[model samples]
Target: MSLLIIRLLVFVLVFWAGWRLWQYWQGFQNQRVEEQQGKDGHESMVKCEECGLHLPSSEAIQSGKLHFCCSEHRDAYNTPPRDDKDN
Candidate 1:
């Protein structure tokens, strides 16, 4: 009877350890995902000069030295005759 109790106790301990390990692994994965999201957020944002719109750089139209919220704004700023007179 004592031997059986010892075996049962060992099995329970092993099960508990495994459960704890799984929980830790899940937490670690969640932390990694959060870190990746933070990095992506930092990499994504860009400032638009035309209307001071903050948007993802990937979605913004980029002119020579500025970011625009859309192509229309970029083209408006890119008008050659007006740009030339200003320079």
Candidate 2:
């Protein structure tokens, strides 16, 4: 009976230790993911040249190596119809 109790205690201790280790590993992984997201979020902001609209860089339109708020503004600035009088 004493040997069986000792074995049970050892098993319980090992199980508890494994559970705690798993929890720590999960926490570490979550922290890593958050850090990566923080870095990406810092790089995400973009400023629009036309209207000065600040937004995510991924959603902005790129033209002539410049970022624009939308396609309409980018197109308007890119190819303005030439006026004969101005020419």
Candidate 3:
């Protein structure tokens, strides 16, 4: 009984350690990829057409050829003025 409990604890610890390591490696790979894209230049990064914020092109939301930081910005950008009817 005691031996079984010890083995379960050991397994859990090893599994936890491996999961943490995998997460760390994934983050490292993402950072390395971002660095490589920066070196490549030209359209690897994009400016948000709405807020003028810049980010990696891969992360930007696209409407036609223009990019936005998020869906809200994209929606806002495409939406017409409410006062257009008053004009």
Task: Return the top candidate by lDDT.
Answer: 3
User: Sorted on TM-score, highest at the top, how do the candidates line up?
Assistant: 3, 2, 1
Q: Candidate 2: what lDDT?
A: 0.84
| lDDT at 73, model 3 | 97
Residue-level lDDT for 37 in candidate 1: 56
TM-score of each: 0.47, 0.48, 0.49
In model 3, where do residues sit more than 4 Å from their true spots? Answer: 1-43, 84-87
lDDT measured at residue 52 in model 2 versus the true structure, 0 to 100 = 88
**lDDT tens digits, residue span 1-87, model 2:** 999999999999999999999999999998887676575535477788878899877688987679999998887778878889965
User: Comparing candidate 2 with candidate 3, which one achieves the higher TM-score?
Assistant: 3
The 0-to-1 C-alpha lDDT of every candidate, in the order given, reads 0.82, 0.84, 0.89
> Where does candidate 1 have its weakest 10-residue lDDT segment?
78-87
The candidate 3 region of ten consecutive residues with least summed lDDT is 34-43
Better of 1 and 3 by lDDT: 3
Each candidate: how many clashes? 0, 0, 0
